[model samples]
Target: MTRQALVPTTHERGITTLTLDSPANRNALSVSLVEELGRALERYGKDPSVRAVVLTHTGNTFCAGADLKAPAGPYAFVALLRQIAELPKPVLGRVDGHARAGGLGLLGVCDMAFATLSSDFAFSEVRIGVAPALISLPLLPRLDPRAASRYFLTGEVFAGTRAQEIGLLTEAAPDVDVALAPVLEALRRASPQGLAEAKRLLTAGMRDAFDRDAEDLVQRSAALFASAEAREGVTAHLERRDPAWLQ
Candidate 1:
């Protein structure tokens, strides 16, 4: 299927690129976009010619999280994120700009991820009175629990260096293309079977971690979603103002 939300290009060397095309809203994660992304990823995963996948976004921002105006329900967003995480191929996130909330969740799910030196990341959900339910599952394993709690709770933006230091990003390069080149080259050099095996093994190793706390996380998220504070927070953000909770 021809993708409406993104452009998928495959190279002879077996690396597939999925470029986020919805630049108008800073490539916000609309339901359509997430569906398109999931479909494209599923296609690439089934194609033997595709050895690895690279995810990038257009315009100035990598992703600004979910579009407030879009009608993407919470379950849809969470399902799409889970699909990305469960893809068998080695997925690489090439971030050139800002990635926040759900956007940060995308970066966290990738098998390997890199960002531009100028790229910024934040788990700004708490400020909106929502829990980083899906994001925290993948992120907490890669980051220090204390540090993750601090940032997720405070909703503060951090630079790429800090992101790398905290284990959210693997490397910070001068630019997205530069950061991606090495990963692509490495993928090309590695055995596809080996790569897939390693990915499966690592994911299996992390299953216990996820299972242990997934229930509590889901409950926390559900409670946050039902709270008056969350409604007020999302409303205030859509109105481009401070939330009542902040006051």
Candidate 2:
């Protein structure tokens, strides 16, 4: 059987849309998906006609987190996040479904994000015995400390409005496309050089955080994922039973 394209591309006017097409696993970040997404971003990043890149997905779950069965390496995921942050053109996110665990990292990396009010989000790494280490590179600088603390530690789900209130989303309305229309128009109207400079100023701190802490966090993430506790947690999750610690 032929392999299907995991990340598909579409362009309209000056905007490029990259859809996460692996709905079979709720669009989890697998190695192939990450690679394809990086390539797409690189291609659009260099295209002057592509004023902005929109990252969206094709399922009820925008991204269910790391693909447990075939998760991408920590370094690769970090690189993908960095690419979004460093892209010359603005990267926008349109989320109309659920985002959990590492998936939330995508929203944080976007220059701006819009979601439907009914969409939900969560930072679920804790339940699986790992910290949200790599994702914090983009999220920590943007998220409200108090809100981050609550969700990060508790692993609770929050609606798009709460996500927006905590800085994870730019806007959450009844319709994501409606919310994004004006922003897309503004992006199309803005000068390319102007947008690049503005994005540089906006994302400098995040890029610095990546440089300062990404390696250490990657090591930390690898260590955690390899631990006995994490193994048990993951196994239990897959088995649909409570982890040992909860007993």
Candidate 3:
């Protein structure tokens, strides 16, 4: 069997769209997927013709978090997130599906995110006996504190409207494309230098958060993933049963 590219790139009118194409596992961040995405971003970041990049996905789920079967190293994942956050050009998000755990990290760091009203989101790490530590690098700075606390602790699912209200989405509408059109048009019109400088100004706080807490959070995340509780939770999830903690 031939393997398909995990992150596929398409260029249109100065905009580059990078699709997360591994639907079989709900586009989980596997080692290969992260590497491919990181490399693609690097290439696009240096391409003068590419004005901006759109991070999107294919499948009912945009991303279902990490691929436990072949998860990327925490440091590698953190580096990928940093790459996206610090990309000189604007990175937009277009989502029409569910995003959970680390998936929301992708959305959080995007300069702008647009999703269909039907799209859902969750901070599911707690239910899996882990924490949303690494993802907080981008998310904590952007998310509403009260909402973050509620969703992070409860692992509750929220729809796009609520996601927007909580500062996790730039806009959520009946049609994601409709919401994204104007933003895309603006990007297409702006000079690359203007876009890059504007993004730098906007993302300064997020970058600071990354520099300040990334290592400590990465260590915490690695420890949690290695713990017996996380093993039980992951095992129970794969087995389609409740973890011992739930019982």
Candidate 4:
């Protein structure tokens, strides 16, 4: 049997682009998809010809976060976030679509991110009886504390402009590609060593924190996902009903 492919890669002019190709579920982070994304990053990240990597999705939505129905989930997803954060080559995000829950977690790891103003985001985990525990690695550092508190508890969907204002995004464009191109081109012209060293300098403290706290966060996340509250909330969501916790 053929393994279904999730990350398909292309390389040209010192840039490698990995497209998250699963559209059926809005490119959700299934186990295999996370694994494939890790493998793809390792593959291109080590190539001498590659100076940078671009992560983009092929669907209307970038990612829906974890596949709640998967018996085991969002564990390997944490490792994937670490991989993206540590890639010696710069990783730029091309988000032309909405990113939700853990999806925003992955976006937070991008060294630079460009999203379309049309795209919306939410920390929907709270609404479903869990918290964005593991994702807070890359997330909390980039976000304004007041903004983070408001959004984390409310789970409200915010526009790209608001996201940028709160430090979740570097820039928002009317057209995603238009915002992404010049950045990629500028990265392509940069000295590989310069980019690598700068990225390392820029993210050292962040990565140190991720390494220090990731295991604990992952444990917290798994516990939450396995809880009665999460199970009820997720089931209610799938069934299109209000969860019991809601008034």
Overall lDDT per candidate, in order of appearance: 0.79, 0.94, 0.92, 0.87
Top candidate (lDDT): 2
lDDT of 2: 0.94
Error of 3 at 236 (Å): 0.5
Off by over 4 Å in 3: none
Ranking by TM-score: 2, 3, 4, 1
Task: List CA RMSD, all candidates.
Answer: 2.4, 0.8, 0.9, 1.3
Off by over 4 Å in 1: 1-4, 7-12, 208-219
Clashing pairs in 3: none
How many steric clashes does model 2 contain? Answer: 0
| Total backbone collisions for each predicted model | 0, 0, 0, 0
Model 3 lDDT at residue 146: 97
Off by over 4 Å in 4: 1-4, 71-74
User: What is the TM-score (0 to 1) of candidate 4?
Assistant: 0.96
Q: Tens-digit lDDT track for model 2 on 2-106?
A: 888888899998999999999989999999999999999999999989899999999898888899999999999999999999999999989999999888999
Q: Positional deviation of 239 in candidate 4, in angstroms?
A: 1.1
Rank order by lDDT, top first? 2, 3, 4, 1
lDDT (tens digit, per residue) of candidate 1 on 41-122: 8899888777898888888888888776784566666666666666778888888888888888888878888988888988
Report residue 151 deviation for candidate 1 (angstroms): 0.7
> Each prediction's TM-score against the native?
0.90, 0.98, 0.98, 0.96
